[model samples]
Target: MVSLLKNRVNIASGTPSRIKKLIDIEALVLSRLAVILLDIHPDVKGYSLFTLPQVRDEFWDLYKNYFHQRLLEGDLRICLYGPLPSGNEFKGKKST
Candidate 1:
């Protein structure tokens, strides 16, 4: 018996190359913000943008203190947009 399949290659055997582009941290943040606001595919959570040692210091300074605050506020807005539960909902619940 012969198989009709042609060129069955093992895709996992190949390794990818690292191509790093040095971009201004401010510009990178702004472009990411634009993509998020515009409802682009593969959103912010899908990326790991800051990995290079050259941008580590600047990335932490801009992201951890500034960008993180903005993201938290955005989350707050989304969280508060729905009907919230009242204390009455927990009247019969016991603390475990």
Candidate 2:
């Protein structure tokens, strides 16, 4: 997760509206990238990401500071799924 607003602030270069637009752009690009990757590799059901504990904590802090309000009031939800531990193909997987 990129801290667009904080980074801008650190370098002294962001308005509230500008930061909002940058965050939105990043979210949109990441969403689209997921779709594109799925299309490119049908066997790739999804991705698993890991982070250092400190980084994970920082991410939550950033999320609380920036996105908590929008998440509570807006139509947004987090979805998680369990991919097969043995990879994408099951014993009797069907072919597309």
Candidate 3:
């Protein structure tokens, strides 16, 4: 199977190399996001995020906080999203 990306550049429009790089990177990020979000209710447009037993909003707050902290800590950043009761609280941290 071959992607239309050809050898990294568009075979027709001839997309700029820099733009292609940006798109490739974004695609990688989004693919990871999709995998994480699969644990969600499967209806979120672009959200997964929950901490306290299906509490969608709370989950996102913790997720973002942890995400930034991980970034600051120079750790690989990825938010875990799920709908299980265990989502209620991880590490004693609850939604604000």
Best by lDDT: 3
Q: What is the lDDT of residue 56 in candidate 1?
A: 37
**Best candidate, TM-score-wise?**
2
Q: For residues 1-95, write the lDDT of model 1, one tens digit per residue.
A: 13525533221111011111112323233323411211112224532222223333444454454456657666311122223444453455453
Q: Rate the local accuracy (lDDT) of all candidates.
A: 0.32, 0.37, 0.39
lDDT of 3 by residue, 29-70 (tens): 322222122244434353233432444553454346434455
lDDT (0-100) at residue 16 of candidate 1? 12
Q: Show model 2 residue runs off by greater than 4 Å.
A: 1-51, 83-96
Question: Residue 54 error for model 1, in Å?
Answer: 2.5
Candidate 3 off by > 4 Å: 1-38, 41-54, 79-96
How far is 84's C-alpha from truth in model 2 (Å)? Answer: 13
* 1 against 2, candidate with superior TM-score: 2
Better of 2 and 3 by TM-score: 2
Model 3, residue 34: distance off in Å is: 18
